[model samples]
Target: MGERLIVIEHEAEAGLGCFAGRLEAAGVEAEVVRPYKGEPVPGRAPAGLLVLGGAAAAWDDEGYGWLPATRDLIARAVDEGVPTLGICLGAQLMTMACGGTVERGDAGLEIGLGEIEPLPEAAADPLLSALPSGPVRAIQYHYDAMTTLPEGAVRLATGARYANQAYRLGDRAWAVQFHPEATPEIFASWTGGGDLPPERAGELNAQVEAAGDELRRTWGKFAEAFAAQLTRR
Candidate 1:
């Protein structure tokens, strides 16, 4: 009802944070379906789709029973020209669903604030065209990387470690490795489980906090652009 976008949330903590508010403010209602909590994923996205990030590897269908269905939904959305945005693990899933490859990065885990530079191709992109020309920092918290892109995907952005940072499949579907929706608190919660050293975690959290205004300004535009896509559809 009233311009809804189906959001596939992979985990509890990975739920829509800032993007939720941004979408609402842009007049796009987000209907989040949490597969990690046994919520069934729909077979299609009638209006649009937003697949959030998670800790699970993209190929671990056996581990995440709903992943196969989720992949199917992503493929269907892309095939039907639905507006879709996938972040982090969602990006990995989109890559794999569209005949790309996602593997554990040989460069190790890419966590914390990272720089992502928009490519020349992004200048014509609907979602990324408004991004700053130079490198912009975003919250990065993922181990697996998209090693190869889908056959027809347009590479939108790149980073130092991971070459495939952002890409657009078909016309409306997009996938980005960085976390545009992560707030400082949400990122802190992610690092709170002692996965990283205390000092490192604190440092990363501080960096995110310091960059809050910039992150909101940059990524909030990205989210609003996506919301506009949904509303237009």
Candidate 2:
């Protein structure tokens, strides 16, 4: 069969967005699977897997009927060395699915554009190595944090608010707490339409727009590196 990246979208609002163009530019085809719309999770691993963000907690399998199956798929993908990228809630699921811990952050909500500092270990990491050594600005919108990583997982990046900003499992699997794929429009839609105060939403929207160029520059390379890893495998 031809190569493809299977994207599991948990919500209609949190679709592929900016990541779609980047993956396409890297010559990686994406097949979005909306599990929230009754799409069944795949039984077998694809060439690559991308689990996007969502509103539900990682352990809320009862609330999201497909989460258990999705978690199983993530575990299988990692075990099989499939190139997998899990963002936000996806990362929490990856952590929980593989014997890690996910909990509501005691630091309260970490929402808005923020910086991620790459750990020294990230210098040699396949996906993170391509990123600059300095703090990289990324979109952050999550209430939960990964208190513990999966067994044998390598912590790639860390932040002040949340230490577990990014990690790698096996060789190809990656889980990131921030949203590298989010665009300013998406951020605005999330903030402006949500319970965010009008002034707060406006401020974040401006920050997202201001940091747009840098975010794309850094995350575009990240997406390319991830695709390269999948190609090599």
Q: For residue 41, what is the lDDT in candidate 2?
A: 92
TM-score per prediction, in order, is 0.98, 0.97
Q: How well is each residue in 1-233 modelled by candidate 1, as lDDT tens digits?
A: 55899999988888898898899999998899988888999998989999999989999988999999999999999999999999999999999999999999989999999999899999999999878778899999999999989999999999998899999998899999999999999999999988999999999999999999999999999999999898887
The C-alpha RMSD of each candidate to the native structure, in angstroms, is 0.8, 1.2
- After superposing candidate 2, which stretches have Cα over 4 Å from the reference? none
lDDT of 1: 0.93
Candidate 1: residue 194 Cα off by (Å): 1.6
What are the lDDT figures for the candidates, one per model? 0.93, 0.90
What TM-score does candidate 2 reach?
0.97
